[model samples]
Structure formats: structure tokens, C-alpha cells
Target: MRELTRDDVNAAVKGGSVFASGGGGWVDHGLEIGHAALSIGRPKLLSVDELPDDAIILTCTAIGAPAGRDWQMLGKDYIKAVQLIIENYDGKIAGVMTPQNGMSSTINGWLPAAALGLAVIDATGDIRAHPTGKMGSLGLASSIDYETIQAVAGGKPEIGSYMELVVKGTPARTSNILRTASDMAGGFIAAARHPLPIKHIKKHAAIGGISIAIELGRVIMEAEPDGPEAVLEAVVHKTNGRILGRGTVTTKNVHYSGAFDVGTIEVSIPNRRLTLHVMNEYMAVGDDEGTRLTTFPDVITTFDLKKGLPVSVGDVEEGMEIAVFAIDKSKVPLSSSVKDPTVYPEVEEMLGIDLQSYAFDKEKTIYA
Candidate 1:
């Protein structure tokens, strides 16, 4: 296990921003939470094999968009959310893991772990940012026997939108409740839920997920001195990612609603155009030929042409020169939900577009 440093946090944010796919949590919130974790204690990164198979692990994440108002996710709330889950579980709680990687989601376990003196397991529900809790629940989505225990704390009561919620039920039921609470809380909220054994994590979760983000972040940072193109190359080389298109942003239309920021982005190349479908994050990328270049489960990131830094969908705007990058799903670690057909319908219905054509192979398993 290794302790996280400020430099590590900076690198993770840069890398996390890319994996965030266009949305995760806010970059500013990620910085604040990361710094706070480092300051209070040593947040240790642990591999799945390091922990006992019988130990219990809970997922800590920020549920909501950064665009809304009246929702205050205080630093203390992260810890409180975890504490609530610990109280609910009558067994030993060994560590915490992130549901997915994002600007803030990547660091979701840091503050709670540091405050509670728990290990930050180097595994994730999903390698990239996803919209719903079920999408990051490993394969627990179909497990009717896996009882879910959830705890949520966020929102400011002054505006009639503050709540500290806890629920016990099926994974789907509990997940929906939290999403609704987040929407009612203005836009987002602090959430902790899903208790699983180390054995289960080792079998289904993406191992070394945090380390991958850190390495990718470090590579991007190291290339910064050279130039944006070098930084772009480093990003692609490290993840074996592909550059879909490079051009100025011609149109960006995204709106925050129902605790999710959804929309589309259009990039104009010299002779071709690239379009990105967004649902909190860039879910799919397609060209003028109607061929889907990349889809969900794979990482779809946009880099600022001048800054050479990864940018999110919530932050992208028209007239900005940017480059769209994609790493095939086959090359990246993915959760079982990525292959689950049930999760795609909501996103497709929201954007009114079909994405099943680009879905990842369902036959693959982490244990394999």
C-alpha cells in the first residue's frame, strides 16, 4: 500500500477528468476533497489481494451534477455518509472503494477513508464514469438476494431541499430513491451504499483501477512541459486510446435536469464532423457516416487544444478548439453493467438515439 501525495491527487484529477467522460463531479470539488484527505491522514491505496476475503467494503460516491444549486455537499458529509453505512452493517467494515472514476468520483473514497482510518482499495465499480448506481453495481443489478443498504446526506434546508436519507431494499429500488433524492436536493448529494465482500470485489470489480488513473494522470502531466500535442499523445499511448477527431467545437447543447446533465456535442474537422452524445458524460461518439466511433463503457474524453488538459461535457462550449479521444472498450476495464442491456434503455430514451450497436462484449468477465 502507498500513501497519496498532492502531486498524486493533481495527476489523478487530470486523468480522472478524462475518464469522467464529460461528467463526474466538479474539478474544483475533486481538488478540495483530495487535498483534505491528504492533509488529515495517509490515504492508503490497497489492492484486492491485500484485504481479507471476508472483509466488507462499501462504495462512496457523490450523486448529482455540479450545475445545480441549494445542494451543499460538505466535506464532513462524505464521512457521515460512510458512517451511516457502517452503522447499518452489523459486520466488520474493512475499506472503501469508488463506484467509478471521475474528477471527484475517483477521490470519493479518500476523504471517508482518511477520516475513518480505512484503506482506499484500488478497485472500482466501473473504470469510467457512469450515470446510474446500478451501472456501477458490478453484477449486483440482477441479484435479487443482494440486499442494498444506502445512506445519503446533502442539500441545504433553507431552500427546502436538505435531507439525510437512509434506505434498505433491492439494489434497483434503493438506487432510484437516491437519484430522486439527489434531484430533489437541487442537483446532487453525497451518497454511500452497497456492501460487498472482498471476494466479490476481486471477482467483479476492476482491480488496480485507481493505479491506472494515477499512471495515466502522471503520464499526461509529464508530457505537459513539451506541448498539448505531446500531452495528447501521452494520453493516447498510455491507454491505447484513439483520436476520433480534432477540430473546433461547432455546437454544444447540454442541460442539467433530474440530477443528470444530458445533451450532445458537435466537433467540426477539416472535411468531416464528429458528434458526441452526452448523459452526464460522453456516452457515444459517431461520425458523418453514421458509424459509431465509440460508445459507453469506453473512455471518451475531450482535450482543450490550447491547454492540453481534459475537459468535461459540462465545461465544453462552442468555438472552443478541442480534440476528441476514445479508448476502445476492449482495452479498458469495465463493470458487468456495461454489458447489461437493461441500463442502456434509459440513456437511449433520454437522447432519443440507439447505442446498443456499440455495446461491449457481454461474455467477458473480470475473473476470466
Candidate 2:
């Protein structure tokens, strides 16, 4: 176990932004929570091996659409979410883990760990940012007998949006309810849920995912002084990813629907058009001829060529020159949650594209 420092926080925001795929959380929000955690108290990070196998670890996360205009989640909201879990649950909670690697999601557990004296476990529900809570449930969604207990807190209290809810039900049903609560509570909220044994987390989660984000952030930061090209090159080399396309975004069609931003983006290259399907994050990339270049579970991120920073789907605008980078699913360390076939149907249905064919095909190549 080690105490987290400011540098670690910076690295996490930078690296987690890339792994966020498209949408995880905002960079500013991530930095705010991370720095605040450091100031409040020393936030310690521990590997799963350091904890007892039977120890219960809780998941802390933010749920809602990134494009929401009224979204307001404070640092206290995160801690309150965890506190609600502690107040209601019967088990002795040993640590906190995040659902996925995102700008803010990567450090979601830091504040709670710092203030509550809970260890921050270096594991993730999904290595990359995904749309729904079920995708980050670490395959608990597939278990018929497993019940999920989730607590949420956030929103603008002055505007009658602030709410706190604790619910126990099936993972899917409870997750949907939380999404609804997110919409009611100003389109974004902090959540703490699904306390599980360390042993189960060890087997199902993306182990050491936080460290991966930090290292990737370090790589990007170190290369920033060189130029955008250097930053892009460094990221591609670090992730074993390749630039799928580099061009100006010709058209962007994103809109808020339910609890997600669903739309598509078309980029015009020299001779090819790269289309991106979105449901909160970039779900899939395809060529002009309709050949899928990359699918979800694989890392699909866009970089602002001018700034050399990973750009979220919401930040993309028509005529902005960006480069789409993709890492094959086989290249990244995936959790059991992303590998579970059960999670793909919701995303597939939402985006109207087939992900299971590529996500699970062992013989499938990025260009195949």
C-alpha cells in the first residue's frame, strides 16, 4: 500500500481521460476531487493482494449523462454515498473501488478513502468507460441470485434536485432505477454500491487498472512538451494502439436521450470517412463503406490534434481536426464484466450495432 500524491492524481486524470473511451467524467472534476482528497487526508492505495480475501469492498461512482447542463456533484456527495452504504449495509466494509477508469471515475473512491479511512483498492469494474452501471458490475448482472444494494446522493438542492436513495434489487433492475434517479436528480449523481468480497473482486475486476491510467498519464505528460504528434505517438505506443483516422469532423449528431448522449460523428479524411457510433462513449468506429473498424471493449478515443489531448464525445464539434485512436480488445487487460456476453445486448440495442461479434471473436483483428 502507498499514500497517493498530487502527481499520481495528475497522472490519473490524464491517463484516465484516454481510457475513458469517450465519456467517463470531466477532467476538471477529476482534478478537483483528487486534489481535495489529498488535502483532506492521506489517501492510500492498496492492491487486492494486500487485503483479506473475505473483506468487503464497495464501489463508488458517478451515474448520469456527461452532457447534462444542470449536473452538480460535490466532493461531499461522493463521501455521503459511501456513508449511506456503511449506514445501511451489515458487512464490515474494508475498502473502496471505482466502477471504471474515467477522468473522475478513476479517482471516485479517493475522497471516501481519505475521509472515511477506507483503503482505495486498485481495481476497476471495467478498464474502459462504458455507458451503463451493469457494464461495470463485474458480471454481477449475470448472477440470478445476486442482489445489488446501491446508494445515490447529489444534484442541486436549491433547485429541488438533490436526492438520496438506497435500493436493493437485481443488478439490472436496480441499475435502471439509479439511472432514473440520476435524471430526476439533475441528470448526474454520486453512487456507492455492490459491496463484494476482495476475492470476488480479485477474480472479476480489472486489476491494477488505476496504475495503468497513472502510467499512461505519465507517458502523455512527458511527451506534451515535444508536440501533439509526440503526445499521440507516445499514447499509441504505450497502449499498442494505432491511429484509425485523422481528419476534420464534418458532422456531429449528439443529443441527450434518457440517461445517455446518443448520436454519431462523421469525420472526413483525405479519401475515407470514419463514422463513430455513440451512446455516452464512442461505441464503434466504422469506415465509409460500413466496415466496422473498432468496437466497444476495445479502446476507442479521439485526440484533439491541436492540443494533443484526448477529447470526449461531447467536446467534439463539426470541423474540429482530431485523430481517432484504437487499441484492439486483445491488447488491453479486460475485466470479467466486459468479457461477459450479458452486458453487450443493452449497448448493442442502444447503438443499433453488433458488438459481440467483434468483442468476443478471438480471431477477429481490428481491420478484419
Candidate 3:
């Protein structure tokens, strides 16, 4: 067992989440609360390689309305979600993993593993953050109607409700229900209940996201005392990512609906500029010249002007000075879900896209 640091949390959050393709919850929320959990008690990072071949590796994901509800995810609510998963399934929990890259899902990824003495494999679905429920992931492929999945929450007596997300299959869609449960309870619920043994981890899943979050956090910490330039350089150097463009947020359009803080952000620096379309999470990022700077699965992180720390997606307002950086393309693959194309169309479609077409190699890509 080892103590997790702010760096480890940040690196994993930033690195894994970018693969979310605008789905995972949010990067900042995960890093902040996950760090808090560690501060209270050292959170352990388990290597999948260490687990027994027969160990069951369950991907604990979060199904929720708002992607940035980490603040409300306190105390036993997290554990309750875990309990639900364990209780619902007959398999023994030997390890933990994440479906989405953001806070709601990833926290339990590392948390359940450390708290329960289980290996936490560094694998996930969406790299950045996405608004759709867990079933919408590459894991489900668009095959499973997003509504048919399950949604769970630990509010007011571990409440659960079902909706007819699908006329057939797991109707009431417990997956989507989880998100609503979190909204009603003021937090998020755990998901990706299907369990797999350690052997499947090596065969699928992103191998090393925890280390990436750590490195990303280190860059932020180093830049906090220095300057944005220093932080920018740190991120670029450490992750081998790129500073697509740097400028002040000139315009911000925000609205609150259905647990999502959807909006648009425009950043202007000197003669260059960029614009980001954000749903509950940051979606498409492009520039005025029609040059789309980023694609799905690669997280686009934004920071405040004064403090170098990351700003939560909920707190982002109009005229907020910020810096947007693209995370390394070393994103975790959706292979686990890839097997079930009916549910994981997004994962399969993107899998066929070939990263080489995007000019991002397997190693890393960093440009300023």
C-alpha cells in the first residue's frame, strides 16, 4: 500500500479523463475530492499486475445528472454506492476500476480499491467527461439505449428509482436513474457493475492513468507559485501535451438545466483565439479559423486567471480568465466495452477512427 499524493490524483484525472470524449464527469472535481479523501486517510494505488488471476475487477462508475457534483459526494454516500454494487452482484470484489474519467466515477475507482484492500486498475471509458449516463459509454456502445441502464444513489435511505429508459431491456434504466438519484440527493452514484478478473485488465483498459494524473497535478502545483507560462510549460513538458492556444476567456454563455451547466467559452489572446462548446461537460473545442483544436476523449482543461489551480466546470462564469490545455493522447481504450458493440457504439466507432488520422501518436503529443 502507498500514499496517494495530489500529483497522482491530478495526473490520473487529467490523463484518463481526456479519453472521456466529453463524457466522464469532470477532471477538477475528481482531483479535488479524491485528494481530500487521501488527506483524511492515505488512499492506496493498487497495480492490476499484483492482483490474483481469479480476482474480480469491477469498474465502479458514477451515474448522475451534474458532472461536477463532487462537493455533494461526501461521507458514507460513496460507500453506500459500493455496497449497492456488491449487494446486487454475486461476484466477489477483488479490484476496482472506472468507466468515466471524471470525479463521480473515478473516485470510487481508486477509493473502493484502497478502502477495501483491492487492486484499482488504471482503466476507464470516456477520457475527459461526458454528460450521458454510464450505459452511453464505449462500454455500452450506443447499442444499449442510454435509458435502459441503471442509476443508483444513497440519499434518504439509499434510495433507488427506475424509469422506462427502454421499452425492452433493463427498462426503468437503473443506470439513468442513478444520475437522477444523485441530483435529488445532491451528489453522484457508482456504476459499471459488471465485474471482471485481473486477467481481463491486461487484455483491456487503460494501463496507467494514475501516474498521468499525478504528473498533471505536479505541473499545476509547480505553476501555481510561478506563472501560467511556467505551468503551461510544466504541463507540456511533463505530459508531452500541447498548449493549443492561450488567451483570456472573452465570452461565456452558461445555463443550468438537467444537472448540466451547458455553455460556450471563447478565449482571445493577441491575434489568436479559440471557442469551446460545453454541455454538462466541455464538449467541442475549436478556433475561429475553423481549425478544431480538439476531439472527443482528449480532455480540454480550463483554469482561473489569478489562481493557477483548476476551476470546477460549475464555477466557470463569463469573462473568467483561463488557460485551456489538451491532455496527452495516451488515453485508455474502450476495449472492455468494445466486445459489446451493441452497447458501445461510440467506443467502437472511435476505435475505428485510427488516432494516426488525427496526427496524435501512441507515445504523446505536446505543442504550444
Candidate 4:
């Protein structure tokens, strides 16, 4: 186990943004929580193997649309969410883990861990940012007998939107309730849920995912002084990813719906146009002729060519110059949750695209 430094926080936000796949959480929010954690206490990061098999681990995450305007989640809200879990749960919680890697999501557990004196486990529900809590449930969605305990706290108190809730039910039913609570809390909320044994997390999570984000961030930060090209090149080399297209955004149509940012973005390349389908994050990228270039579970993210930062769907304007990058799912460490067929149908139905064909092929070895 090791204590996280300010440099590690910077690296996490930078690298976590890339793994965010366009919609993990806001960059500023990530930095805020990360720095706050360091200010209060030294948060230790532990590998899955470091913990006892019987230790209970909880997932801390922010739920709701990244683009929501009235969203009001603060550092206190994150701490409160975890406190609620600790107060209500029967066992002694060992540590906290993030549901996925995102600009902010990557460090979701840091503040809670530091302030509460718990370890930050290096495992994650999903290596990349994905929509819905179910996608980050680490295949608990398939366990019919599993009961989920979810705690949520967020929203602006002055606006009468702040609220706290604790629920117990099936994963699907409880997750949907949280989504509804997010909307009621003005579109965003912090959540702590699904305590499980360390052994189960070791078996189902994307191990070492925190290190992946930190390493990627360190590479990006080191290359920043060189130029955008250098940073992009360094990212490509690090993730074994390739630039899909580089061009100006010609059109962007994003809107908040059902606690999600759903829409499309069109970018004009030299001779063709690329379309990015969105449902909170960039779900898929396709050419004008309808040829799918990359799909979700694969890392699909956009970088502001001028700023050398990964830009989320909400920030991409019609005139900005950006480069789209993709790392095949085969290239990243994937948790069993992303590979479970049970989680794809809702997303597929929402986006009206085929994901199961690519995400869950019987012949592919996703979790070796």
C-alpha cells in the first residue's frame, strides 16, 4: 500500500479523463475531491491482494448526467454517502472502490477513504467510464439472490434539492431508484453502495485499474511541455490506441434526458465525416457511410487538440478542433461486469445500436 501524493492526484485526473471514455465526471470536480483528500489525510492505495479475503468493500460513485446544469454535488456529499453506508451496514467496511475510471469517478473513493480512515482499493467495477450503475456492478446484475444496499447524498441544500437516501433491494430496482433520486436532486448525486467481500472483488473487478490511470496521467503530464502532438503520441503509445480522426466539430446536438446526456456529434475530417453516438459518454463512433469504427467497452474519447486535454461530450462545441482516439477493449483490463450480456440490452435499446455482438463474443477471452 502507498499514500497518494498531489502528483498522483494530477496524474489520476489526467489519465482518468482518458479512461472516462467521455463521461466519468468533471475534471474540476475530480481535482477538487482529490486535493481535498490529500489535505485532510493521507489516503493509502492498496492492491486487491493486500486486503483480507473477508474484508468488505463498497463502491463510491457520482450518479447522473455530466452535462446537467443544476447538478450540485460537493465533497461533503461524498463523505456523507459513505457515512450512510457505514451507519446502516451490519459489518465493518474495510475500504472503498470506485465504480469506474473517470475524470472524477476515478477518485470517487479517495475523500471517503481518507476522511473515514479507510483504504482506497486499486480495483474498479469497470476500467472505463460507462453509463448506468449496473454496468459497474461487477456482474452482480446476474446474481439473482444478491441484495444491494445503496446510499446517496447530494444536491444544493439552499435550493431544496439536497437529499439523502438509503435503499435495499435488487440491483436493477435499486439502481433505477438512485437514477430517479438523481433527477430529483437536480440531476446529480454522490452514491455509496454494494458492499462485497474482497475475494469477490478480486475475482470480478478490473485489478490494477487505478495504477493504469495514474501511469497514463503521468505520461500525459510529462509530455505536455512538448506539445499536443507529443501528448497525443505518448497517449497512443501508452494505451496501444490509435487516433481515429482529427478535425473540427461541424455539429453537436446534446441534451439532458433521463439523468443522461444523449445526443450525437459530427466531426468533419479531410474527406469524410465521423459521427459519435452519445448516452452520457461516447458510446460509438461511425463514419458517414455508417461503418462503425469503435464501440463502447472500447475506450472512445475526444481530445481538445489545442488544449491537450480530453474533452467530454458536453464541452465539445461545433467549431472546436479535436482528435478522436480509441483503444480496443481487447487492449484494456475489463471487469466481468462489462462483459456480462445482462447489462448491454438497456444501453443497446437506449442507443439503438448493437453492442452485444462486439462486447460478448463467446470466442473472445475478455477476462484472462
Give every collision pair in model 1. 22-313
Error of 3 at 354 (Å): 17
lDDT at position 147, candidate 2? 83
State every prediction's TM-score relative to the real structure.
Answer: 0.95, 0.98, 0.72, 0.97
List model 2 lDDT by residue over 225-296, tens digit each: 999999999999999989998999999998998779998999998889999999999989998787888988
Query: Could you give candidate 4's per-residue lDDT for residues 97-165 as a string of tens digits?
Result: 998999999999999999999999998999999989999998897676999899999998898999999
For each candidate, the alpha-carbon lDDT, in order, equals 0.85, 0.92, 0.54, 0.92
Residue ranges of candidate 3 with Cα displaced over 4 Å = 1-43, 65-71, 103-106, 134-138, 142-151, 156-174, 190-192, 328-368
| Model 3: how far residue 120 lies from native, Å | 2.5
Q: Order of candidates by TM-score, top first?
A: 2, 4, 1, 3
